[model samples]
Target chain A: MIKVEWFYWLCGAIFIAVAALTFADGTNAKRYGSGAFWGLLGGAFIYSTFVVHKTAPASVLGLAVIMMALLVATGQLGRGDTTGPSRAEQEAGADRFGNRLFVPALTIPVVVIIFAVGLAKIHVGSEPLLEKSSETLIGLGVASIVAVIIGFVMLRPKSPLAPLSEGRRLLEAIGWAAVLPQMLATLGQLFVAAGVGKQVGRLTEHVLPSGSLFGGVLVYCVGMALFTIIMGNAFGAFPIMTAAIGYPVLVQHFHGNAAAVFAIGMLAGFCGTLCTPMAANFNIVPAALLEMKDKYGPIKAQIPTAIPLLACNVALMYFLAF
Target chain B: MLVLLGVLLVVIGFALRLNPLVVVTVAGIVTGFLGHLSVIAILNAFGNGFATSRSVTLFVLVLPVIGLIERFGLQEQGRRLIARLHALTTGRLLVLYLLIRQISSALGLASINGPAALVRPLIYPMAEGAAERRFGRAIPEAMREKVKGYSASADTVGQFFGEDIFVAIGSILLITGFVDTTYHLKLDALNVALWAIPTAICAYAIHGTRLFLLDRRLDRMAEAAGLTTRPDKADAQEAGR
Candidate 1:
């Protein structure tokens, strides 16, 4: 049997090796630096999980691997610098928005989230919601993939995003990364559904103070937000956190509105999207798409906005809810 | 057992990197199997989810329409319209949009697409065009990019602050239920929604002022960029004629 620690070490080694390979390629370096950055980031994350010991290291490593591969495969990092029209220059003509690679890239996380949520909902006999959600996500993924392929075919620029000769190669890279989160999230759901959450709940009840609804809500929201920042997607964090606090304390004992609380709480969690590097889709994609001088330009712009909003959400719960 | 199997299939399928559609379809099949329903039952669930969330689909459809409008002269016309009005600055334009976006969202019409779906395609382009008309070229790419960022930022702020004010929104309902159950406070969704209005108004006002200041800042940047060649009043009058 493979020990978890051994798996971590192996994954860590793989991530570092991949990072080295990416650095070697000049063309790959520019288009997909974010992916390499994430591979290293993932390694750090997996190592940290061992330190924290409160979370699953395998899932964290899994997601990081997927993100790393996707970024590389999609030519997000090492595409040759061809600084086209600036926003001002583009404003001169009609076709200023440029190639919308971010749109398809976005589908990766969205599909992962929907798949995770559907899996969670299914455990509760909300079979219909689960089935529908899965189908919708699948439909969206198919549409996006097909659109991107067709765009590549029709738009066909000379120094294309990927090597046309290696068309299958690009697809394999993206396809590998794309499937990971869905699997991990499902595993997470199963772990939670199969009574891991119940154990977590028991531990929390003994440790936390009684009659501390405020504390509960605070912990839950902050935990969700922080976890999302770490994980990059709130949906990934949702099942685990909700399984622990949301189901046991918030919904079951406290009688909070399950749907509203989860939805808004998740939104509150998404506020972390503005601050963290881990939420590469929100942080890194905009940078890659815009080619900003400062790598953290998107995050810098978002802080002024996200911090106050998080405070408001907390206050909203206290003032409005309580 | 069936539900368990369905869940397992979903987990394994995604792990294998199969097409997301294929993974999901398999998941749906597994779910239906567990529920002791046939293939038709699974298909119906898919239809039902779409039908229930039709509003979201409508929001998606609005994107192409906005794209088409921008394809015409809508954005340029908007910029020309604003440029002629001299009183309108970048900040003022964004602040106005923030208010509109917030108010609409608060009214439970959060379906109105912003930034990526609307502002990027329409509002930012027009604002840039207007800035160019007044300043006469030389706008930096960084500053222009900042404009796009700000446009998206405004939409996000407005949506985040305003949506809670609508009592009917899922967030408000959630808050009420939590309060009622935990502390036994007997709070109403309407109460939570109503209370959110003041906060929403405050958000609008605060964001609006920031937008105004942003306009001043952009104006300075424009001046620094040596884009201060305002169209002559006589020329404007001639153009008007």
Candidate 2:
């Protein structure tokens, strides 16, 4: 059965390719720094494939993470000047391709849907075709490869190296911000393993006044959001908040519906995600991807909606959860 | 309380605008140390966490395809398509995307859309194109930045609230599993998933209204730029000229 490991290998190869391209680019003054950063990331990806299976020691991967961090911390990472087509060429290409240009771009979502919903369960004599643990991620890997091939058939550039070069350009444009998501996810995990949640849970439980349902609901929703902001993911914050106040205070004392309280409570945590750069994937990465002048642009845009939605969540839990 | 020192470090580091990676690494180490973990154990946590979380960064795989198509003018095509549909304002277009993203995610199709795959390459251009067409001139840099922000916001809000209503989603399973195992309460995943609908609808109404208000903001920006009062006249004038 195809597993998620192969996809990591593919990404490792891609990162290596990007590193090679960076090394080859003479225009970037910090090419070595940038190249080393990507190269380290590439090695980590390949190395992680083994680490995940317990085939290798994880400490090496840990050491690599610190080294990559040092590279960025010291102002080593920088972008090359690799660019895409000129404005006139983009216009001409658009006119030439017309609606056809959308085919490969749109295929990603359509094919992901097909594989995720339909092909995920199919078996070849009892071995699942896709890895059960990560069918969606595997589907994403497959969809991207198919999309790139389709792009090649349609665009037909002079060099087969076009994809790598262009991908490198975009990668450099994103710079260190691209990896921030994974790094934050790592931070979230560390937060969990460090018992940070336990500390916070104890504090919240102490602070709450007993038998006040509104106070219980308010603290549960707000604590979930606050803890998620600290941890960078609602998933990490959920069990802590639930255990501290949700189960004992709200559900047991007030007889709140587990479904309504917890479901809306998670959404409340999402509100914190909108407001925090710690939730880098949803906020910071997008700002960088869109090439905005301010990295916090997405976060600023989200706060208005997040605040109101969070208030609504509090109201929903108070009135409906019981 | 002392174990929460890492949390305090994070808040201070971010407030001071230090390098996030460095801040995070230090914070993790300090947190681990306070939690009484050995060096090897800390390293193990770091490595294991990074490895397991690889799924978060899988958008890297799609980069080559996105980069290649972009070089061949995928964004230009999006712009041109939006330009031709003059009636679809930026707000209306984004509201439409919010609905699409929300509904599609509700059906267990969250993987189908994202910042790298859809928003940067397709949605941002279309929204920007709509803004430019509505204003009948190049939009100011600030307005363009706002457009980008709104585009990303729509995707986030839609995905965050919408995906929970799908019973198979991890969040629902987590809710059910935790409640059932911990409290010994028999909870159905469907029941948990179904409760998400009201908040989902509230998210749509709240964010959908914000998006539509964005159109009015753009109109005010256009008027401040001394463009024609009516967008149609501005369009006709640009064309006739």
Give me the candidate number with maximum lDDT. 2
In candidate 2, what are the lDDT values of residues B1-241, reduced to their tens digit?
7878877787677656677678878888898899888999888877876676666556677777777877777657655553453346789888988897798678654644578767887788878877776665666788898899999999998998888875545566556545543455656555676789989999999999999899888778777877654555674565455
Error of 2 at B24 (Å): 0.7
Give RMSD to native, each candidate. 15.8, 7.2
Using TM-score as the measure, which candidate wins? Answer: 2
The fnat scores of all predictions, in order, read 0.01, 0.59
Residue B168: error of model 1 in Å? 12
Expressed as tens digits, the lDDT of each residue in A1-322 for candidate 1 is 1122332343344344445545554555362564465354436434544433534334344344334444544555443332322445324432433333223323333443444444324444433433332232333333334434544453343444332222222222333333333333333333333444666577677766876887777777787777667655554455556666876787677876654455456656767766777755446655554455666765775677666766765666544444
Poorest stretch of ten by lDDT in candidate 1 chain B: B50-59
Model 1 DockQ, alpha carbons vs. true complex:
0.05
* TM-score of every candidate: 0.45, 0.71
Candidate 1 off by > 4 Å = A1-192, A202-210, A251-260, A276-295, B1-87, B103-117, B129-142, B159-209, B216-241
Q: TM-score of chain B, per candidate?
A: 0.59, 0.63
Candidate 2 retains true contacts at a fraction of: 0.59
* Quality of model 1 by C-alpha lDDT: 0.49
